[model samples]
Target chain A: AQSVAQPEDQVNVAEGNPLTVKCTYSVSGNPYLFWYVQYPNRGLQFLLKYITGDNLVKGSYGFEAEFNKSQTSFHLKKPSALVSDSALYFCAVRDMGSGNTPLVFGKGTRLSVIA
Target chain B: SAVISQKPSRDICQRGTSLTIQCQVDSQVTMMFWYRQQPGQSLTLIATANQGSEATYESGFVIDKFPISRPNLTFSTLTVSNMSPEDSSIYLCSVVPGQGAVGYTFGSGTRLTVV
Candidate 1:
């Protein structure tokens, strides 16, 4: 079975400061990791994904994530947080060997960019 | 990437009534899925919508209570039967667009409130 854990339920960061939301996963085989954002009353928007390449992956809205295999983590990051960046962020993972399997998501982390 | 349009963005229904949420994709997709996001909770996979067969439901979810219909490749529907307060949540539809490894695309979501 594959599972993801977002250690923080909420993260507060000042605007223009770097923000980081932690995520870690457990899977039997190789993993496919992803990050998504959901604004108020809106659908989830894809941020970025880590399949099988570079350790660092950049995504939409000036967000990026680093996939650390040794640590079994994929933490979302932003160089400079914006007030609009505040939203619910989710980290998801699936076994790469498990073909077409549904993604197992973390509990989610609420990011608050304080002005 | 494929675009998805979901109907009934938000609804308030009486207990015991049913609500059917629809998802329409702009292009053909191989894999479509339904998920539920309870208040302040992570997204849960309800089922995988097969194009011409019965949906494959996840554990703790029954076919009788959450009937799914996938008449074609571009469209699908999920009906919530015998609605209760516990069923009040945001239902979302998602699809694996081109490749299985790429991230999935999601619909705007349907918010159901049972009273």
Candidate 2:
């Protein structure tokens, strides 16, 4: 079965600094990756996705992820972190072999942007 | 982009009772999915709700425990039956409007706390 792994449970970053939330996936075929954010008492929001074409996929709120095929990693990054950007982040993957297959998500990374 | 609205945003239910969470999408969608997010945990897909067909549940979830209904293309519901403390979690509804490895939009999850 395909699975995504977020090794870090939490990541602490200072305000205005660059931030990276690591994500790695294991799939039998090509992987379709995505990133989502969740604030307290709210639903998950779409951040970005990597279907094909560009390895570096940019998303909402100035977030981007680099899809590394060889390393099997799709890490979420932001150029300048904001205090409001602190939330729980999830990395998800879907196999490219079939269309109906549901996404497999990682354990999630809690980003705490300290002022 | 489809806008999804989920009802009963947060509810405290008693054990052995059931709670049915509704999901209404702004537009028609072919694939609707249900997921559970335990506190401080990643999402686990509960089932795929298909219109005019029985829901396809994932491992560790059953139709009896979590009955789902997809009466039409734009509406669906997931009910947590005979609830327990372990069933206390956020239930999310997701939909992918198109085919292929595209990203999905999620509703503002229903947070259920069983006691």
Candidate 3:
């Protein structure tokens, strides 16, 4: 079985400052990880993913995440935050060895980017 | 990436009533999933919709309570039957377009308020 963990319930950052939302995972096999953002009453938008290759992966809206194999973590990051970026973020993971398997989600992290 | 449209955006129904939520994708996808989000919470996988096959539900979810249908690769529906106030939740439909992409794309969601 695969599972994900988002340690923070909420994260707050000031505009122009860097931000980080932490995520970790537990999987029996290799991990396929992803990040998504959700606005109020709207569907979640794809952010980025870490499948293989480099530890650093860049994604939509100038966001990126680092995949640390040793730590079993995939942390979403942005150099500068925007007030409009405030939203709920989710981290998901699945076992790479499992074919067409459903993803397991973390509890979620609410981000509040203040101007 | 696939674009998904879900409706009835929201609905309030009396107890013992039923509601069906629809999801249509721009492109055909093999894997369609239904998830539920309670107030102020993360998402929980309800079931996986497959064409010609009955939906595969997760633990704690049953077909009698939540029925799903996948008439084609691009369309699916989820119905909540004999609903009660406990069934009130934000139900979302998601899809994985194909191999290579890491995360899932979601529909705007249906906010169901059962009274």
Candidate 4:
């Protein structure tokens, strides 16, 4: 079985400042991790993913995530937060060894970037 | 990434009624998944639909209450059966185009409000 956790329900950051949303996972096999953002009245947009290769991966909208194997974490980060970045972020994970396994999601972290 | 079209975008239904949300993908996808997101909450996997098989539902979800259909690779539907006020939520559909796809493409989501 695979599961994900986002410890914080909300993260507040100032515009132009850095922001980090934490995520952790528990999986028996290698994990395929992903980050998605849901803006108001819009579908979720893919942010980034960490499947293999580099531990750090860059994604759309200048967002990035670091895959920490030791910590079992894949935290989403942005160098400079913007007011537009205020939205709900979700971290998902699936077991790589399980063919077409459905992704399990965390509780999510709501990001609020103030002007 | 696959482009998904889902609708009715938002609906308000009377209690004990039902609503069927459809998802059409631009490209062929072997698996389609249905998820539910409550207001101000995270997402939860409801089921996985394959073209020729019945949907495999996650724990706490049942096929009778949330029937799914996948008659082809690019199209699927999920019906909210005998809905009650508690069934109001944002229902989303997602799919992976093929192998080597790291992240799932999601539909804009259907906001169902059971009154």
Per-candidate TM equals 0.98, 0.97, 0.96, 0.97
TM-score of chain A of 4: 0.98
All candidates' lDDT scores?
0.94, 0.93, 0.92, 0.93
* C-alpha lDDT of residue A2 in model 3: 85
Checking candidate 1 for backbone clashes, the offending pairs are none
lDDT of 3 at A26: 98
lDDT tens string, model 4, B21-99? 9999999999999999998888998999999988899899999999999999999999999999999999999998887
Task: Write the residue-wise lDDT of candidate 2 on A1-115 in tens digits.
Answer: 7999999999999999999999999999898899999998889989999988989999999999999999999999999999999999999998887686678899999999999
- lDDT tens digits, residue span A29-114, model 4: 89999999999998888898899999999999999999999999999999999999999999999998887767889998999999
By DockQ: ranked, best first: 1, 4, 2, 3
Candidate 1: which stretches are off by over 4 Å?
Answer: B99-101
- For model 1, residues B58-114, the per-residue Cα lDDT tens digits are 999999999999988899999999999999999999998876546788999999999
Candidate 3 structure quality by residue, lDDT tens digits, B1-115: 7889899999999999999999999988888999999988889999999888999999999999999989999999999999999999999998888766656788998999998
Candidate 2, residues B2-114, lDDT tens digits: the string is: 89999989999999999999999998888899999998889999999889999999989999999999999999999999999999999999998764427688999999999
| lDDT tens per residue, model 3, A10-50 | 99999999999999999998999999998987777889888
Q: Give the Å error, residue B75, model 4.
A: 0.7
Clashing pairs in 2: none
